[model samples]
Target: MSSPPIITSSSFSSSNPFSSLPEDVIRAHIFPRLDGCSLASVGCVTPELHSLSSDHQLWSHICHSKWPSTTTSTLTHLISSFKGGSRSFFSLSTLPPNHNIPSPSPSLSALPDQIISAVDIFYRGKCIFSKVQATETVSGWFKCSPFRIDLVGPKEAVPTPISRPSHEDTCQNLYADLELSWIVVDPTGHKAVNVSSLLPVSVERHWLSGEVHILYATVVCGHVTCSVEVTCVGGGPGGLVLHVTEACLKMEDIDGAHLNGRDSLVVLQRVLEGKRGNLCSENRKMGKVEEGRKKYLEFLERRKERREKILRREGRLDNLCVMIGSFLFVGLFYLLCFY
Candidate 1:
């Protein structure tokens, strides 16, 4: 130190080392700030860049950037949708009838939970698929997929959707045979819904832009439906759940279908029952939650406790207010502070 005349690196290293770095280098530092979808996109820019992004470090960084405040499940679902994975099954759309129905005394808004429960009961296990096709002379047709989702309310059902192992080498084809959908239930009820029917998907590259897009065709109810362009997205560990927030079903398409609203609800109820039966059978095989009867009972107990706790908390707050008022009354009348 004496010989070097007290040279200090911290005091004088002010030159912008990174400022002069190449654009790619700058991008490396900047890109980690982006979410998974954007980061995946960045990797496709070039072969060299793709190699750099292949590092697990980059993926972890991108995953963390996925959503700042969302739950891991919520973020996973969002990412899955972005990646063109299974569409969420549970969607919450208000039944704004295409034609005016009688306005109820309390109005539909006042009893949303009832409306939702009724709808859920009606369509729980019945899949409603729509066909969307793009036409040269008219709006394209969109074919909807149909697969019923078993409802366990807000609780995660014992057997998860991810349990099935894949034997196929290709990830795309692995899930191609099975339809996937999602249902998201927040404390207030429904959030977002997605429904995806599986079909063979082929992605094509834009020669000029280098971007990727998907094309697929599948037989939807005996009709050969096709789409030239579709978003490519994937799901995460906790299977995505979606609920339609605002939806109006046009009853015009119900001409040939034997399933009426009540019948649909009955079908849903039976499907749920069948699922419970299957789960029970599977549990017997796995020795977990046998019959699900006990599990259902336990769920009810937990729900009761939660309601009680909420009521007790509200009561405590009210009592505290009363006690505070009583103390203030005595203080103001009797000069308690001086005493």
Candidate 2:
């Protein structure tokens, strides 16, 4: 009688459990279970998975899941133009922003006439508000005037089921409840980037109207940075009805000077082109919102230091000018007295 051959676990079942399963099963069942980062890691396991993970459909679904506003037909069409479709987009928008930007010179070559902003506001991991707004850049008004994108129109109250907190805890309440995603898509450039910190950078109460202003800021590329503000007002209990009284994004310099549309768009395009933070390792740990803000905070500190240096330089120049004028006046006075 021949000895029964031992059946090792590895021999009985292929080392790669997925190898035995049909590709369709893996694509339809397994890949969908993973996120963009996890799916990307699985792709590295074998050539087969790399192919399966590259499926545009899977990435498209992931994109739609994270950003509800990406489902819009206009934005969908724009996403399709990306080199690898939604996969390319996920890569750009998922990584922490790359603060390094090239020359701020305006370029109309690849600049789109309009941009689509896909915004989602989440509270405690559940989406409470989602909207898509289109901002037209072709207007002369846009170019000459300040660069701003208003998602919520005046007199428009976007109701949410969140309770208005007591005046004292309002700031903390808003900070704890809200996390935002603001993805900007460019059709002509075929680029997309999330220009938000995923958390409110600042929350302040208006001393006059009792309104709360929540600000989310990010460094666009170079000296130019962008910030989005969502203003929320009080609603009677159950009227816990939340309204986005104002949801506006404005781009400005470190010195608080607003950039014109052309210049703002140029810096924005540089962001789409340069994302040095894409080094998100496989099995990617998407950074914590607090950690994501490190670069932003550092940028702010850098700006502060720069401003102080400028002020010091100007002070020295002023003192030198004063001394030169005083010396000349005194010399003339002595000459007249002697004469």
Residues 267-323, candidate 1: write the lDDT tens digits.
222222121111112123223212222333344455567678888999999999999
Q: CA RMSD for every model?
A: 25.2, 6.4
Regions of model 1 farther than 4 Å from truth: 1-28, 60-147, 151-339
Error of 2 at 256 (Å): 1.3
Supply the TM-score for candidate 2: 0.82
Write model 2 residue lDDT over 62-126, tens digit each, in one string: 89987788888877888898999998988888754666665454467777888888888988878
| Regions of candidate 2 where Cα sits further than 4 Å from its true position | 1-13, 102-106, 236-241, 276-291, 309-339
The alpha-carbon deviation from the true structure for residue 77 of candidate 1, after best TM-score superposition, in angstroms, is: 16
Query: In order, what lDDT does every prediction score?
Result: 0.30, 0.76
Q: Once model 1 is optimally superposed onto the true structure by TM-score, how far is the C-alpha of residue 216 displaced, in angstroms?
A: 21
Q: Lowest lDDT 10-mer window, candidate 2?
A: 3-12
Against the true structure, what is each candidate's TM-score? Answer: 0.21, 0.82
